[model samples]
Target: MSKPPSPILDLSHTGLLIAAHGSPSTKGGRTSSRKHAETIRNLGLFADVRAGFLTEKPFIKDVLDGIHLPEVYVVPNLAYRGFVSTTKLPQALNLTGEVTERITPNGHQRVHLCDPVGTDPSTAKTFAVRILSTMDSLKVPDTDTAIVVIGHGSGRGRESFEHTNRIARDLSRFGIIPPVFTTFLEEPPFIKNWRDLTRAKNVIFAPYLISDGFHGSEEVPRDIGFNTKSEIFIERLSHVQPNEMNQDGQRLIYLPPLGDAPEMAELIINRVRASLT
Candidate 1:
């Protein structure tokens, strides 16, 4: 009798680590990280899916140190390539090489650094959909409401702000006729200028961020002259009581962060597969 054929090993079943800037508050504070992992697992894209974070406790290094995988790909859950994507991430992983660095610390496990989720063009399209959907749900007039996408803008690198601007521009094609502008956390046309950027009396504040952490929860509202009660303000404005708007102003609605949309997951998986080839 002929010998039985040996089983084939599928190297594509390598492990995937979805890393993000984690949060300290709430359960599974790494919301985006977990969502990306789940999306990958749900799509049957990878054999193993794990999560890591930069901020908060249990940094990426700590998480990677405990996990065991044949080949690990550190995919940032962030939208753009800023400090986290450049210096902090590489140093945390002990990586020393070029942009697409592949480092094997102690020659044990191989780790590959993949492009951030924001760099992918597909992300722009996904963001467009999220903004429109939020507008629809809030019953805001697409033609009258000004959609503002808030990003963690950087002065050193224009990539993050550029990506955000592209996303806002892309959203215009969706028939939201008023205007789509972008604001930043570190750059000009800051949050304070939000009221002046658009002519729409009703504003929809949508964060172009991945998590509902400090920037989304605290800083954003404080910058706008309100407190952590931003959601309350948004809800109250949705109905637009006659007395709410000041003598020279109109109501403003703040939407939640665009965290781990299904389309975002698709974009990430596609980017990773493309990078591998």
Candidate 2:
């Protein structure tokens, strides 16, 4: 005869933990984490939502230890798959379940590693829309303005830059002819030749980045010049702290982080639900 559904299934509790490459200099990292947590909380889907880090202060161990939830799902807030996403995060969290074959430390927490946000198509669309909107705000004509998608280009893994380039290429189909070029802190073009790369006098500098930390605050401006003569749009995915902006005029507009966008929250939820099956 058919028996009643297992009682153990009813006792199961699900949790979500977002892991990011944490920042020590600026509070952007924490802000992103908080926003993700809040989104999950607002949805009321999971029993708990927590945040962890791969580097710099409040390590993964701390986050795992702090969580009271029994079963947890860890979503890496990283854009690309690299040391942090592939090795560092998994090693630190010691996650095990349907994904992990063997046992490791912190195995008590049923942790599932969700793919990085950047890999999601929704994220790419969101970034593209934001960049385009930022350019529109600058009164930079689509024909004249050249959109430069500045990413933290790296020699280690081409994934980071490639993802940005892919987004740019996809958005190009929408008639945004703004030339999308990529420069790196470690690679060539070096943010110095940004103007030369795209011969458009009206250039929209959008950092295809998530946070406004070292790269966003100092390096980007230092090399590219803080001259607001040309429109500058910093496309970040985290909230902008008051100190980050010194509003002189509308010449330079630091658009809100992609995380603040409700679209992002929807993307995260969709990603989670898709992975469940």
Residue 74 displacement in candidate 1 (angstroms): 1.1
**What global local distance difference test value does model 2 have?**
0.60
Candidate 1, 1-277: lDDT as tens digits: 0221122334355677777888776347336567667766765556677777777666788877665665667777787878888788888878664323243453466667888877776766666666667666656675566777888888788887887787778776755566778898899779877877876777777778876567766677567655555566544422321112222475666665666455666666655665666
Q: Per-residue alpha-carbon lDDT of model 2 for 1-277, expressed as tens digits?
A: 0222223232236777777777776674445665766766765566776766666666777876676665666777766656667877877877543364333364554556777666677666777777776666556676655666666777887876677677667777655676777676777767767756866556666666654455665567656655322333332323342112332322333444344454555555555555676
* Model 1 pairs whose backbones collide: 79-118
- The true-versus-predicted C-alpha distance at residue 60 of model 1, in Å, is 0.7
lDDT against the true structure, per candidate, is 0.67, 0.60
Give all TM-scores, in the order shown: 0.79, 0.77
lDDT of 1 at 108: 61
Count clashing pairs, candidate 1.
Answer: 1
TM-score of 2: 0.77
